[model samples]
Target: MTANKAVGPTEAIADFVQQADFSTVPVEVRERALAAFVDTVGVAIAGHGDGGFQTLLSTMRPELPTGRATILPTGERTSAMMAALLNGGAGHALDFDDVADQIYGHPSVVLVPVVLAVAEEVGASGRDALTAYALGFEVCCAIAATMQVREHYQRGWHSTATIGVLGATAAAAHLLRLDHTRTRHALGIAASTASGSRQNFGTMTKPLHPGLAARDAVLAAKLASNGFTADPAQLEGPLGYLAMYADSADPSAVARALGNPWELARVGLNVKKYPCCYNTHRTADAILDLVRENPVRPEDIAEIRLTLEPDGFDPLIHRRPQTGLEGKFSPEYVLAAAVLDGKIALASFHDEAVLRPAAQQLLRRVSRHESAVPPIGSGEWEFAYSVVEVETTGGEVVRHRTDVPRGDCRAPLGRDDLEAKFRDCVTFAGTGLDADKLLDELWQLETTGSAGPLLNLSASS
Candidate 1:
């Protein structure tokens, strides 16, 4: 039970995946898993109209092999790998999926797609699917935390794509019922494809990273289940993934935290209230709060000033976004939306939204300042905090600050809010399923017989 006595990184991870199940998972951890399930499915459904997922579906449709698992946005069936690929992309296409500070990435987008796809493919029960998700999510976050994910991310590697692959693989392997040996092979196989670049952040390719991870998870798990071999040692040697990506950290330490604290509970998940890059959320929240307190007229706005810690705005790379996707990475655009549009919704990131003359005018007045404190989590605030200063043409000034957004772990969204978000997403998808009924089925996931009925109930009718 001691850290030092834990097995090698690969072995420990595989053992955890192979052994974790519904009964073994803690109640809160299972609840977190269920939240991920509900949120991811709803977001993926909302992706029906998203450009990225549409483009992907069009591009890959010709080659897709048919199977029984659901394809998320379309309700059609496809191979597990194909379903995972498309579902994952759709889940993240709108940038509305859950976020996690633990991995500094989106965990559910990748893990949920793979779990749903493989669980349906293998006839696994809803409880089993939920358990698989918990297993995968913990493994992914654990690996990223141990690997110094922030640095890995800052170096232009997308941790959601790179680190997320292992999480997807873990969940897929569990749902597929791979043994310890095969699970080790699956984990090692997954590491080989742990690739995604932050350079793709503002492009259609951005959401595709998680899609690729999801598809690869199914590939790795299915391959391993069929006796595909990989040297499980690919995770730790001098040239291994951890050594190449992480700084000084013991694998055993990472192993100890696997389920002890249950990263899902300890680290927490952020169900976003906005559909933009998480980097701009707190600032957006502050802007909305300031506006709500004293509705700031767009015409009277003289300047919008935002203060953030160093590295806080690192991921919001697009200074003046030219496209809707770029706008998601632009704090100026997001803040402008908060003021001019009075809200940030799924439509807020559209090309027309970013191109509106009013939005463009307001974006110019927005400015960002750096705080003297350390970057998020280590600084005086202990998490991402933002200060917004709005000055009017008439010299009236309004100020507001936010330490955590509404949906962040520390300030978690209530069940009603989560369900409301789900209803809105399902309504947006226009899938016609009774959002309330499907939501009830989802909430009773532990009692559902298998993934088949849920997917069937969600099927567009």
Candidate 2:
């Protein structure tokens, strides 16, 4: 993964990771990253029982060593690597973590968990943890920028796990304070294990992808710090990470992306309003807009049509999902639930909510189609959008389109909305965690003594 710092992207990245400091990060970027921590912890709390995580933990708990690293809401202690895996998976179990359009994956789920766990293991200060996270995110976005990524995504490689492993590695390596040479080795170790298939979408395995990435990253960094070695030229080599994964590799993409404009400041992160596949957010927002304005009853609707540009429906594979997890990926299910419930809440994704007779009948009334047209000036379909049209039994048609749903960088949720979301998830999980105290702690994370106690503070009684 090492390239010349003055001459190549990957090397410049290693240099950046080694040198990054929290005080040097801009105020706005730090604030956004802080908000990301609060949102991620809240959603992960709500995802406690979903994704078959409890069952998976039953198998792991017997051998899991008790340590300072804490799992969200559970108050349980485990080794740093196990905590990272558990917390990362739980953070993404609801698919509600922040997203970056650049990578088409959740960043905080991988970076935050890795930073927190490794920071705890190393007794690093919160300021250092926060800086490590930003560095990791930049590295993740940098790698994604280095190729013709449409193929990597279209071919079903979940970049969150594939690219995110390296991000996690960068964060952990930085927190571990590995020098440039060891950091390169850590990234190389990460590349060797980075993998997550899009085929796992809609299943428990989907959320587990980020957890595995987090675990692999911690392992990679710890190993490199302990003198493990890997192929130094694992990035742009003829058969390296980028060569094998990217359809078309760019020799300079990585160099151009790493902080030239600062991806965090440019692309920014998306705070999700709904707890489902991000691909379905536009459709959810659009359909909800249509129904709330029209005041049409579910039974009075004859058909609901969802239209998008090519590959828009690629991640929405389950049309008549039989389970709650499956419903998270179903536009049909979301449209039906949104129309009936007035909002897409944590309750909306429960098995009973998904399988209820009314929801199932309404689901059948939805039909999805794709086209090749963008919104005149949007340029490409990569910036995904959705169009929803509702036709009532009286033949009345109403339509709505959502290009940037609320909570997007352009249409961010306000502070009250963000805090309300955190409080709601706490209540929904019946966690009894101190939401107000936790919110204050998160906002002041940079000044805190250690990052580990923050999670322990949020643990349910």
Candidate 3:
């Protein structure tokens, strides 16, 4: 294959489209894809009843065509695009979706939903869908690598909603097997779909961002497949995605290390154990470890202080969170719930618990500060704590710090751990989706020969 002289937006996307295929993915990548798949479905189903997600679904129901793709929680069948948007929105509804550290974004939010919807629409095998996920996952990480995502996100763009469109577009293009030109057009069209704001982080709009991005990505690809056109220089031109979105733009990074290296292999995504923002993970881990090693009763602690990276401090900066949804992003609320309740389960976010007197009292006593370096890639400098000083009124002080947080890709959860987490999520979702059969089918998806059973679980109410 001859490489293009100058990589235009469409050409760059087309190149990836031609190079990627189901057979190209390795076994490890396939396993990770399965992990992401089951995790997203579980979370989405669990959050299917959320007011924001349900409202979005209801609104979209009347506008979509009848199709094979299933609407999770309610088991309704709808067009692939509609299913993508609804499920994508629901996945992040609880704010417990996956995150990518290097990109300062959420990759699975849009990628998983879009890919799965297409899988159902095309009758793609589980193995093929998993491969599509791997391809999409790699592309998402690559764009982030080129964009200097941390800076881009800090300057106000929500990476999950913005960078995710390109990745999702790539996935849809690859699965649809569009030639390089059409693929490029899809990428170009996706540029317009890029949108999200950090101001909505603690609110319902935050989760909706990814859902809309997923739907938009499918639309972009579908339009491209139908011969719709877009700017050929949307990514590399002087006034492209970088120029328009970031403070400083680098066009070279967009195509740098295109063949020899891949960003997806280097920048591993974070699989969240707690249903809270990624910034709060390290602190929650620190508290959980402290309580475990030297178990302390709720009444024994007097005050607590949490230190975080500069970027980490901003996301969960809420002081007074009145609702359970707001409480998920509030560091104070999470810390209080973790300390007072001993476990921050799905129920921890219940309205009554969030408004509880003891949780509020602990919330008042807890304070968070900034660290020197931003905790991003590699577990080394990510989130190091000084000492969690638990000033006890009984003339004693307890201290602990997290060397490494659980579910940190480095110290990742094992198969058993993941299974437990999936079961927990399924139970909380109240979907009655068979856990054992689902896991078995997912693991043996390559030869399953039918997506109906898998789709049925998520489709039925």
Best by lDDT: 1
Q: Sorted on TM-score, highest at the top, how do the candidates line up?
A: 1, 2, 3
lDDT of 2 by residue, 253-289 (tens): 6766666666787778989999998888998899888
Compute the lDDT of residue 415 as modeled in candidate 2.
91
Ranking by lDDT: 1, 2, 3
Q: How high a TM-score does candidate 2 get? A: 0.95
**Mind giving the per-residue lDDT tens digits that candidate 3 earns over 316-360?**
747778888888888788778878777778788777889999888
User: Candidate 1: where is the Cα deviation over 4 Å?
Assistant: 1-4, 374-379, 451-453, 457-460
Model 1 worst lDDT window (10 residues) = 451-460
Give the lDDT of residue 391 in candidate 3.
71
Considering TM-score, which of the candidate structures 2 and 3 is the better prediction for this target? 2
lDDT of 1 by residue, 1-461 (tens): 11334666788787787678688788888888898899898899899888888889999999888787888777788888899999989988888999989888899999988988888888889888888889888888778767778888888888888888998898888888889899999988888888888888889899999999999989998999999999877787667878877766567656776776788777679999988898888988989988999997899999988888778988888888888989999999999988887889888888999999998999999888888663333457876688888999999988888888989998899999999999888888876767887687678887778636347654435
Q: Comparing candidate 1 with candidate 3, which one achieves the higher TM-score?
A: 1
